[model samples]
Target: MRFTSHTTSADGITERDFVHDGVPGVLWTPGHDPAGLVLSAHGGGRHKRAPGILARAHRCAAAGLAVVALDAPGHGDRVRTAEDERFAIEIRSRMAAGQDAGALVAEYNALQASRAIPEWRSVLDALPALGDRVGFWGVSMGSALGIPLVAAEPRVRAAVFGLIGATGPLVRAAAAITVPVRFLLQCDDRLVARDAGLALFDAFAAPRKSLHANPGGHGDVPEHELAGAVTFLAG
Candidate 1:
């Protein structure tokens, strides 16, 4: 995963408001010229502007990577258009109706995932025209979402998973990925504790994988650890 750098200005914080499963998002490149693209996912209860993920996007793009900070189905601009106030409520409501919460979220995710991956991938597909390689970067819930993309997609040469070490869905993804991976978490993270995330990291089937811990809450991956993520994606 050799990522290059280039300068970029956010094309726009456009909402996929009109497109089916379209996610409103920011599209930007960090440095002078980018070497790759990072599909960014935010943490639980948060949207794509999450500080930690954005910080890494700075470094990645500075290193020449295009960044697409994703707005999960019920997040960002999408949250505004959601029939409900938030995705959690929507999930809870569906579950209350005897709908499988996980299945519903997965269905919602599946519908939106393809739209997103290709949005970022389209940037990557066009990257050769710009001269770069492409990959993904995600945190907390976003990292959880990245599991499927990393597992089944061959285009993903590298992945950065942080702020989240595990999830209910991740239990099944334990050995699904075969790509090089770098995982990070907070030691006393109330949101994602060291133990649980570590357990998930242990489940990775990648021949090459690494993990690091810092002191922080669930909201973001700390500044000190940002280098580690960039290093991982850069690796």
Candidate 2:
């Protein structure tokens, strides 16, 4: 894991960019012994540095938690294939036509997760300094990939996820995730079906889990809710 760039922010946070086995990612450190580490994933059409993800990383870092975010397959610096491009085009078409695209989106998410989960495990293998208490933060496409990840990775102690559904292999995957989960569900998510999201929350086998339903459509998550997520991750 060779660092490509390292810079310190005025607020005493250190941001470092690196690549391991061709996977590009960024790490935010608070310049002190971290109590925990949060591994983050971004939604479709968003990269590791998307404003929402960056804000979460910075918020966690300020609370003395090291946060790391990586680009999902076909996102950020990853080379986008023809299939990836076609899928994006189809998503737009289906949404514009008022079609139920959840199944299609779920299939794409499953394929992406197949590659993403292993890559994240590889990240944990490469960065042993991220501490033992690990948590995950992922939204929409991120949650789709992250659900299977937290299920398979015992290193993850808790998770902040939701905004996707139990449509594909994810239905089975969600059953295996037993870590503490704080699920964020937008009441009127335009991209995700409300019933599917609620059903996905119901599928979680976590002994401790909570559903945070907000009154808004997709991408309408409020700022205060983001702060709540930071608090959840920091725990």
Residue 87 alpha-carbon offset, candidate 1, angstroms: 5.5
Judge candidate 1 against the unseen true structure and give its global Cα lDDT, from 0 to 1: 0.62
Best by lDDT: 2
Per residue, candidate 1 scores C-alpha lDDT tens digits across 32-69 of: 55566666777555666666656666677666566766
TM-score of each model, in listed order = 0.70, 0.97
Residue-pair clashes per prediction, in order, are: 21, 0
Weakest 10 consecutive residues, lDDT, candidate 1? 12-21
Candidate 2 overall lDDT versus native? 0.89
Which portions of model 1 show Cα errors greater than 4 Å? 1-21, 30-32, 79-132, 165-168
The whole-model lDDT of each prediction reads: 0.62, 0.89
